[model samples]
Target: MVHKGNCHTQAVCAVATHLPARIHVILKEDRAYELRDLEGRPISKKDAKALIQREYTVPEEIRQRTRGHKKRRRRKEGYIRSQIRGLVTALQASRFA
Candidate 1:
């Protein structure tokens, strides 16, 4: 059985396996230009920040529930943060490592 965290890792590994060896060099040399060229548009820093914030921001319902219970709230927060961190780490490892 695949654990939740390993799902991200495995998916990254699968994609990375199919990529060319020169991908790392291209990523290092002109990462932004390469991405924009492929996408056919430029991405501003503000746009990138907004995209990330939108993707990673926790929902208000989860945040509201934390006010009701101490131990359960902490556990919920930890789980949420861990999942977010795991996704971020996996993405960084796949793209920038």
Candidate 2:
């Protein structure tokens, strides 16, 4: 988790690793947690310090949309699997009938 001021914000970035060294570096990197301006360029040490001190909150709409997309994807995959299973069962029943 990234600690900002008094709040311990959970890391939202998807990281697929269990190695302690890599995890340490990722958590320690402040740039990953900072909300970048539209330009999306690397800033100097002075600028980075200023950005960290500022409080920011992600919009609720974005958080909800992200959750919706994930649920939709899982539902689609489940639908496809059920369709295939039903087809196989129907084929077996027709052959034995």
Candidate 3:
């Protein structure tokens, strides 16, 4: 969670991950844990630093959205399978002939 000192009200930008909504409430508490700003209003900080952790689903989403390259391992497996299929087809054609 990031602090919003610019705003008059005690506010913070809560960035959440793995959440159903792109923007959501990330583990908020009703307690004054932070020191006040110059205006004497308390700084809006999270109770637990661990409260807002990066969501694994986010990177997974990026991986799904991006179609830049084929995974090397999968490509290798496909290549081997393709070679085996080609060899089998060739043998079958010869047997039929």
- Each model's RMSD to truth, in Å? 18.5, 11.3, 14.0
Model 1 poorest 10 in a row by lDDT: 1-10
**lDDT per residue (tens digit) for residues 48-87 in model 2:** 6676555344445656655687799999999999999999
- The total of clashing pairs for model 3 equals 0
Regions of model 1 farther than 4 Å from truth: 1-40, 64-70, 73-97
Q: Which ten residues in a row have the lowest lDDT in candidate 3?
A: 1-10
In Å, residue 6's CA in model 3 sits off its true spot by 40
Q: Which candidate achieves the best TM-score against the true structure? A: 2
Q: For every model shown, what is its TM-score relative to the native structure? A: 0.30, 0.40, 0.33
Give the per-residue lDDT digits (tens) of candidate 1, residues 1-97: 1222223456568768867665766686865433232255767777766765665454556545544576787999999999999999999999986
Ranking by TM-score: 2, 3, 1
Which pairs of residues collide in model 1?
A: none
Name every residue pair that clashes in candidate 3: none
Model 2 lDDT, residue 56, Cα: 47
**lDDT scores of the candidates, listed in order:** 0.63, 0.61, 0.47
Error of 2 at 63 (Å): 1.1
Higher-lDDT candidate among 1 and 3?
1
| lDDT score, candidate 3, position 48 | 30
